[model samples]
Target: MKNWAVISTWSMSYDGLLKASSMLQNGESAGDAVENLIKKVESYPLYKSVGYGGLPNEDGVVQMDAAFMNGDTLAQGSVAAIENVKHAVSVARKLSLNKTNSFLVGEGATKFAMQNGFEMTNMLTERAKTIWQNKVKEQFKTGLHPYDGHDTVGAVTLDQAESMSAATSTSGLFMKKDGRIGDSPLSGSGFYADSHIGAATATGLGEDIMKGCLSYEIVRRMAKGQSPQDACDTALYPFCEDLKQRYGQVGEISLIALNRKGEWGVATNVEFPFCVANEKQKAQILMANPGKNQKTQIEPISQSWLDDYQKQINAPVE
Candidate 1:
């Protein structure tokens, strides 16, 4: 292969996977390439909720959360408070490689940063501050997520070359607290990927989604050769109805996956569409949100994406 291809949604733009893959053009481990990609994002302009220019709290301070995981080693690292450190994902990767199994809260994670020689300044970039103050929740009465829109980004890649890994980071709700970490950093919820089985990620509503382990459910379905979309839908459809049936309220979630075969797929509530990377270098975007207030303009990815993904799976290469 030319290097490796990736599929994910937690990077700055829709091209995050493409951009991240570029970091691996030279010979490097998948884990190292991902770490380098995270570091590069720290100074990059597009992803604010990440590194330096993060989204702000209701009180107008920017706090960030980040996490990194490698299925090959099962090593995971994360930093929650982490101010002005630029590369949250890189720091998390360091933590993962260290003696500690995980890192800490705002002050705690910040203290970890300071001890490690990272600067602890306010990430108050002009654009970042503006987004937190004006751009976020601008017209909403509640000042954020008026329609329950989610703001989490994640990536899960098996890579054409080696090892599976996943990473996720987010600013969380537009006007959330300075320390309100979401399910993104937590495994088995927002993001989960494995080398043997599969990788699955959740978006849309973290709290609601956390009420159930969405990622694990999808992986379980994919284990049955159900295809990524079917696995996500089969795992989610029942849970979505169960939540409403048991609680009498509506909620939503989005999920995407890549199996051992380098194929990618995702499913949502039909309202929130996730962008998918097809083998043909094309993107298949889908939205699954459904209800009275639903925005009905989304379209589904073609079935060929799954068929093609499966093409790479040839009887286990005995």
Candidate 2:
């Protein structure tokens, strides 16, 4: 019997994995296991990069994107720039099951969510509002800041039935342009799954991943007989090389992959922590090594930076 396993992009995803473990033990489908995990992550209010409390766009409106892929059928569903829904990943799952529309975006996605009985709620919390306000003030002086480290949350599962499934969800970059869509909802960019080979998901710097279709490339390499680790390493090489040569530092790009044989791997341009869980093993954080030829460490804007920025925002509105 194949050992059932689930993995995700960040440490917080451990909560989701725990829940999915129960479903897998109950003989649930791999797609259901992955989608359930994503839904749980989307509902968490603390993670500011995804679902509720996610950072807003320039207009201070929270929009989310998500994708779901079923490996056995190679069916995909995605939603982009969707607002008011806390569980955007569920909407993506619904779309995949529908099989009529593989993709939906912007107003269309919102409409579909409402028609399909999704709850509409203010996704922006007071904390997110404060961050958005600070970002707007900062952008007025300098152009948009460089990409920060926190990013999309994702999950991939290998089930006892020997199938793979992957899902990803995110509120795109903070203070981004209105209607901007990231790689999260774009198949092959955010995630790819093939039951015969493996599944992969990506996070961070959507633009770079979209350019290379990085997730799909990883799964393809796995199909070519490369181990999950080798595929992840190979797929990240070009991006790492380009960033080092052009900017002298590796920008953010992290990936997680699981092969049909139940082996898993991860690679990143910077140090990233992920979670891995199986029926026989409790979930654990895996600190991934940085990519080859990585030059400089990329740090998130510090607390001091935010404190100073907040002071500027509060300076008597001058």
Alpha-carbon lDDT, every model = 0.63, 0.82
Question: What TM-score, to 2 decimals, does candidate 2 have?
Answer: 0.87
**CA lDDT, candidate 2, residue 31:** 88
Q: Which stretch of 10 consecutive residues in model 1 shows the poorest summed lDDT?
A: 309-318
- Top lDDT: which candidate number? 2
lDDT string, candidate 2, 191-260, tens digits = 9999999999999888777877989999999999999888888788777787678767654789999988
- lDDT (10s digit) by residue, model 1, range 1-318: 542445655324344555555554444456765555445545554454455665666667766777888867777887775566656776677787876648666777777877887656666667656655554546555544553325566667655556777776666666675677777777788777677767877766677777888887777778878777667667776787789999786465767777776666666664454554534455444444443332223356456744543453222221
lDDT against true structure, model 2: 0.82
Q: Given candidate 2, what's the lDDT at residue 187?
A: 87
